[model samples]
Target: MGLFIFNSSIGRKLIMSISGLALILFLLFHSIMNIFVIFSPEIYDAICKFLGANWYALIATMGLAFLFVVHIVYAFWLSLQNYIARGKERYAVKKNAPGVDWASQNMLVLGAIVLGFIALHLFNFWYKMQLQELLAKLNGEVLHVEGAALVQELFASPVYCLLYIVWLVALWFHLTHGFWSALHSLGGSNTVWLPRIKVISNIFSTVIVLLFMAIPVYYLIINLLG
Candidate 1:
């Protein structure tokens, strides 16, 4: 069973679907946590401090990273397989399949864009806060950076704010396609559920994206007005 799961095409898609769904849940939680920063810095900082390099937080972070890596690797592998299976005919017949939307067809490109931004996001925020906290522990020195302040500091800059907006937009496109596709991969492939899943994916992804994008736009407007 284990061997088949690792070696079979359906098994690979199943793994991707599970990992993708897990990451989407993480994103939803993260988006809500960031929203708290807009309301009360104290609350957000407390949450961040609690999560800062603690044993449980570290474990969770490691798990999240594993899911991300698995999702990406499987996605690349599956897309490559599909491309090769189609050969040159892929570009010929269904560059834009009749029912496939742009986002669906361009999912690999969207995923790449989102993956790049995820790195930038980790550097800008994670390196400053949790990584510092972890490093400080190694040196036997106390150090904690309030994540709320980090959000404000980065979003205060128009350029950074705009860059985040771009990332969020890319994320929206990625999630819209990925969410439904994940559902289908996970056994929602019946004709009855197909259209319904797409609608659910679009609505849910939009809500998540808006929640995340709101922070930067809020800060950008505040900075401009100030």
Candidate 2:
């Protein structure tokens, strides 16, 4: 039964839906956490320290990695399948068939952009901070990095700040479609609720992305002024 469900298209979509929802939830939590930096750097750093290199945090990070892998792999798999199924004719159909949202049609491209930026973000923050601490622990040294300092340093550069904003734009586009689509896939949407879901999705996506974007923007202003 497990193999059967995983092997089928509907089941694959179900997996995508579930994984996407899980990621959205994580993003919500992460956004709220990030918002702390704008108002209280000390509190933000404290929270970061609390989540750093501990066993529970490490386990949670691993689980988050698993969810990301599952989501990305399934997304590409489904996209390839759809492309092949649609064949060359899919491109010929230039006009959108009425109700299709722009984001719905370009989800794959947006997702790819989001994935690429995620790598950049992880390298900038995670590699320098959490992973550094983990390595130090293994080497028998205690290292505590200031997360707020890292944020300020990274956002001080105009290029990095611009790239981050671009990344957030892509993320916004991806979530605008993904939020409602995931619910639709899980049987929480219908014609009657579709409009409402889309509105909610947009609001949710915008709020989350803005909360995240605030940190970088705040630091950029601070650095420029000083």
Candidate 3:
């Protein structure tokens, strides 16, 4: 039964939907945590400490990594299957498809952009913070650093701030389409709910992206003024 589901087209889509939804939930939690940095760096650092390099946090991170890999691999598999099924007429059909948002039609491309930025983000923050702490623990050395200070330092650079803004824009576009599409794939949307879901997706994506974008913008302005 499990193998059958893994081999079916619908089952693949279900995997995508489930994995996408899980990532969305993580983004919501992360955005909320990032918002705290704007108002109280101390509070944000405290929250970071709470989540840092602990057993539970490590487990959660591993789970999150698994979900990302599943979603990405399935996405590429589906895209290839679609291309093969469409054959030489794929572009012709896509060009004629009306009422489809640009983001919806180019989810794979958007996803690639998002994935690239995610690597950059991991290097900028995760590698420097959580991974560093984990390494220190393994080495039997104590290493403590304030999460907010690292954030401020990175965002102080204009180039990094600009790159982050670009990344957030790509993320906004990706989420706007992915959010509704995932729900639709899960049978939660129809003709009646389609427009409603689209609206809700837009609003939700905008809010989440804005919350995240605010951190870099805030620190950029502070660096400029200070």
- The TM-scores of all predictions, comma-separated, are 0.95, 0.95, 0.94
What TM-score would candidate 3 get against the native?
0.94
Which lDDT tens digits does candidate 3 get at residues 1-226? 7874479988888999999999999999999999998899889999899888889999999999999999999999999998888777535443545777888878999899999999999998899988999999999986666999888888879899999999899899999999998899899988899999999999999999999999889878888899
Q: List RMSD in Å for every model shown.
A: 1.6, 1.5, 1.7
Worst 10 residues of 2 by lDDT: 87-96
Quantify all predictions' global Cα lDDT against the true fold: 0.90, 0.90, 0.91
Candidate 2: regions farther than 4 A off: 88-93
Model 1: pairs clashing at backbone N, Cα or C within 3 Å: none
Count residue pairs with overlapping backbones in model 1.
Answer: 0
Total clashes for model 3: 0
lDDT of 2 at 19: 94
Model 3 misplaced stretches (Cα beyond 4 Å): 89-96
